[model samples]
Target: MLENWKDKYIVFFDGECGVCNFWVQWVLERDKNDRFMFASLQSDFGQKFLNERGLESKVFNTLYLWKPGQYYYTKSRAVLQIANVLGGVYRLSAVGKLLPAFLSDQVYDLVSRNRMKLANQKCFLPDLEQKKKFIEV
Candidate 1:
């Protein structure tokens, strides 16, 4: 099912992180164009991508957005790119680019460090349709 992902954006996140799961659900609800797909960093598919890129495979604190055959964005860059892809009102997030990436990423890291405290993990069961967006491979 993911073979044609060359044209789709794949989001690799921490499946066990409540904060990360919340954001994934947020994006899914607003994804009017169905341009995104997801995988947990603990999943084989997410680990393969990280290993291929020489990224930290044991840490699940970072988020990655990959556009196959193009490029992948991580941390704050991935967040902004995701917002941009959401389009319409979300395009306003482009303003974040005014700040240097290092500065933006610092904030991202800070949040990542405290993400677990931000929200408690809950049993979130996605509807059948939403389940289809996740790539177990």
Candidate 2:
């Protein structure tokens, strides 16, 4: 099914972060249009993405949303973009755009800094269809 990922949005996440995994699960459950695919920041695909963009690969502090050969969004911007892509009620996330990127990223940084302490949530198991959405997991 990896072949099906062409032209889909890619979400890059911290493989070891429980919070990140939880959100990945959240996105997977809500991706009604099948518009997203995922890869852990530690994977070869992810490393190449990061290296090509001159981003740090060793530290998985930021989330990234990428449209292959197009552009990528990071931090709170990524979250907002994800919400926007999800559409429907999630479009409510549009209000978040009113806040400046600096402010939004500050919030993102706070959560990122303490993500390990904050997320007690366990990532639910993915069904086979959902499982294929991951790239080199």
Candidate 3:
């Protein structure tokens, strides 16, 4: 799906999950420069992206970041890379990179496993002013 993506970062997330959707909204709200494009794991574009990357479609356990021809990151690393792209205070999240990947991923796995339990089903509706930053594709 992303063979033609030339952007610095493409965020792949779980669209149906309230928590995931909320985070996407939060990122868009804070990202004043429109630095990311989103694709749900269930979307055709996302499926094609995973296929092209050789990742299993069934594993929606982590956010996926496709940074053009450079590299890809998952779980905690993905979140951190996204923060770095968003800049400002979000750049602080990059400190997570200091920890061991195994430990960082364990924390990410826990939050992902329990995100549904933490949030209600209502999806956040962004105001018109903030809606332009999000791409549902």
Q: Provide the TM-score for each candidate, comma-separated.
A: 0.96, 0.95, 0.85
Question: Mind giving the per-residue lDDT tens digits that candidate 3 earns over 1-137?
Answer: 33334663678899888989888888877778867767788888788888888898986867988766778889888888889998988898888899998999999999999998987879677777555433445
lDDT of 2 by residue, 1-137 (tens): 78876679999999889999999999999999999999999999999999999999899999999998788999999999999999999989989999999999999999999999999867667799998899993
Better of 2 and 3 by TM-score: 2
Model 3's TM-score against the true structure: 0.85
Whole-model lDDT per candidate: 0.92, 0.93, 0.79
Best by TM-score: 1
Weakest ten-residue segment in model 2 by summed lDDT? 119-128
The root-mean-square deviation over C-alpha atoms between each candidate and the true structure, in angstroms, is 1.0, 1.2, 2.9
Best by lDDT: 2
* Candidate 1 local lDDT, residue 54: 95
